[model samples]
Target: MMKIKRKSLFTVFLLSMFILSIVPMSAENVEIYSMEKLLDMYIENSHDIEIMELEYELTELKYQIESDDLDNKERQMTRDKDDFYDTKDNSSSQKNIDEKRDEYYASAKAYAASTKDLMIQEFEIKNQDKYVANDTAKKKNSFKNDLWQLYELDKQLEVLNATSDLYKSKYEVAQLSYSLENMTESDLNQALIDYEQMVLNSDTLINNLDMLKGNVYINLGIEPEGEPQFDIVPPQSISPVNITYNDLLSSHKSNSLDYEKQSYSLEAEKVYFDILAGVFLENSDDYQENLNNYKKVQLDFYNYEKELDQMVLDVYYNYQKTIDDYNYAKDTVELAQRQYNEAETAFEVGQISALDMDGAKLQLLNAELTYDQSLISCAKATDEIALLMDGISIK
Candidate 1:
């Protein structure tokens, strides 16, 4: 028998909040939600978790009915055995008694097999809550990560707005120059196109943010509530990785639900094939189908580890790259800030034009945008790697 390994809860402590009552937010008032608060609301509103709990209850009910039926059958078998023993004692022919005894033994063996199966069912029922918790944890982690992406998108939109404004100013200048016959018509047209494209990009990002928020609201089982504010900020730095890549891959493979599902399917098909072999010839249609299914599942199971290995490698390397990008961005921001400060001083002393100071300020803004974007990436990547490090039970 293959043992089912229990998965560790990703955020067990956070689950304590699930017991607390949720206050409904009014659409009229603005409410600021931290990532943690939003996650609590999402989990509380989740129909998936509720459905899983309901299914577990239904399974328990089914088990009870089956158990009761088995108990009745066992009592009947006991009575039948007693009667058989009595008949054997009074029988004159040994051969007739021996044949009847063989039939009774077969029936008893089948009863025992069913009882063992019920025992396994009882075990599954006992552990079903853990599975539900694991699933909830997975959703919570994934949703929290999504919120960071939305944060990054919001930052990108801010940069796009600034760039659009800059382009708009240039377009206006080009139009003025063209009116004076100093700029070519084609040049003015190019400036207008650039400004329009920037505006379009900004609008697309805004729409994407709204779409994501809509999905979030749907998950929270809430209507749009006056543009709820996001208060969570991504961490700028993460802890260093301690585990080797190979070890990480091993752990991921061991805990992967995909691998588990494939393994179960392979085992089930093998059992089916054995049953078919007993009932039909090897060349029969039913037997051949069963054999094919078993072969397919077997192949899938064999190939699964390599796929998982590659996936883990990508996640590991992505984490390292995000960290490197963030550090470089941070350094660039510092350099830009220093140059902007010098430009400001020069302007104050009438050593440089106001235009030069403005240019320096724009450089700083762009650098900061890059830093913010990389910060979000680093935070998300750190979370992903940490999930593997902590061994979050994914069901």
Candidate 2:
């Protein structure tokens, strides 16, 4: 019997382990979706936000219970007297109880009303209508911004693909150049190096494309299988305008979600102080406890203000960097185009050897890649700034 029981337990343990092993451990579930659809699903399924909502509901319920207890004050007083008093003095004590009950009823009603009001206020703070509206708008903007970014990334990938083709052409040219008996060992070595570099670059581009596709799948809640197609329309080009540090700071202050949340936090802390000082003062054991709570609120309020200021500064700096990078990339692309033109002219004139021309072509390709990469960096930086300002799309 003992042996059988042990065998059964061992079997159950093995089964449990097998089940655990089969369960999906990676949070990176694949799914296909548009940017808007993905954001909607994320908002609906956000466990953290739901938990906050549950806490608010629980508070409302607690307030209701207190309200009910207050309403039953008279009945409770009568029950208490019945349990304690004898029939003889009961009539006299009943008169005393009636007076006490009226006083208790008035106080209970006041307390219940106050508690209900505070609870409603807390609910408003937790789910402020204006804040909720702002948050929703922010989330929507963020989604649109992300979509723009994805579009930019797609363009970069296309550029990389084009560059890869250029590399293939260069490799072919190198082969032809090496076929010439007049080619020096140094010339052949340079050709080989150019071909190898192009191959490596093409491989890097393919890897990046794969990674971006995976991210898109995850964002859309789709199963990632086979080749992913990203249809991204580039935004209309905007002229480069001089934007100052102050302008960036202003933008961040107006748009940053983190800053807005911190502002709300400060307001909440003030409300907490008011409640602790006004309502909870009487309930507190001593002056010391009240003083401690007051100090804590002050400290929290100070910290929140500091945090908001720092966030504003950080976002402003990031935005500036993004703008600078975009400008630099624009210049680099122009330079690359000029170089490619020069190389083509040189190759046609036969002034430069095929190997040298190929080297120049590879250089132009690298420059173009760098320019595309910079463009991506700028877009990402813009998205980050938007998110900070609370301008992102949220459901």
Candidate 3:
């Protein structure tokens, strides 16, 4: 009986160990999406993009049918012409040859009409595809903007929560001092007010955080309650744009939606002008109107090129400003660290009170938070330039 009891106890111990091992694995199943993964998920779940893609597919299918019809018309026209020639060679009757010739001419006219219709259809399909692509780019930009805003709010919450702890600590110390008759009642009351205010601010931040998270979940087609918790680790160090200004400009020129659209319009206008020149006099109203349109598009194309250059320059300057801000913040942190070290030494030597040391520590915390905020701003600025260069724009 003793041996059996010991065996049972050992079995139970083994089972307990196995359960503990499995618990962590189950807990670890909670997915933590990085920023890139979050962006991917957001894009993947976008209803607007999905709808745009569906519409584009339908447009392509419609155009495909029209294109096939055009091919069939061409084939039929060729066969009719071939039949006309065959009749000329074999059918010596003048009436039959005349009928075949008329049939061939009618088929050619029909083919030309179909060909014109297909040209318009093909252009519509191309324009719709461009719209879908542009809309998707805009959605990606919107997602990045939203994510950056959330990240900024999260950083604010971090600072506020840290400040709350400091406030709570100060209030507790103030109460102890009041009890010992070392602090005035008024001062203790002030400390309590500060701590309560901190709590209120923290609560407000929490509410804002939750609201933003819910908005993000809704955008991602996810239920807030069922979504796995995630974290965003802000960039810790400043990353300078490594490319030259000329390189950035080149990319912007190549990828600019405005440029591409304007260029397409300009070419189309030139084609229209040629058609008008073939059909009408230069002084004719229709020809003049089309010529004006062609020149206007040419002017627009030139203006947009200049605008793009300025935009690239502006982005570069803004990125530089962020780097400067980060550098300044880093200096402030160094100063705060020195102050903290001095406060620590003074407190150890009984030269200052605990509350004074805490004040220095809070300053250090605030300075570090400022530095972190600057770093994130710098990173965000860098990313914005990259996106712009990558052809992301609303227009």
List clash counts for every candidate, in order. 0, 21, 0
Q: Which digits, one per residue and each the tens of the lDDT, describe model 2 over residues 1-395?
A: 00000011112111110100111123366333433344565455444445656655666676666656654653554554354343324556676755554554344335434554555455555554445555554544454455445555555655555555566666566667678755666776776677577668767766776676576456545575456555543322222324555665566567645555655645554544453354232555533565676578668767865665566566557657766876786788788779878888988998877666756666666666566555545544554454444433222
Best by TM-score: 1
State the weakest 10-residue window (summed lDDT) of model 3: 1-10
Output the number of the lDDT-best candidate. 3
Please identify which of the two predictions, 1 or 2, would achieve the higher TM-score against the true structure. 1
Candidate 3 achieves a global lDDT of 0.67
Give me the runs in candidate 3 sitting further than 4 Å from their true place: 1-32, 61-145, 161-201, 226-230, 255-258
Using Cα atoms with residue i matched to residue i, what is each candidate's TM-score against the true structure? Answer: 0.69, 0.53, 0.65
**Candidate 3 per-residue C-alpha lDDT over 1-395 given as tens digits, one digit per residue, 9 for 90 to 100:** 00000111112111111100001113335444433444566778878777877876776787788777877877887898899889989998999998987787667656655555455555656667566665665665566556556656776777788788888988998899999999999999999999999999989987887787677777766653443333444455654677778887787768765566666655655654564454334687755766787688788878877887787788878888888999999999999999999999999999998778878877887898788778767755666676667665433
Which whole-number lDDT from 0 to 100 does residue 128 have in model 1? 85
Better of 2 and 3 by TM-score: 3
Runs in model 1 with CA error above 4 Å? 1-34, 58-126, 221-227, 254-265, 277-292, 349-356, 389-395
lDDT of 2 at 313: 67
1 against 2, candidate with superior lDDT: 1
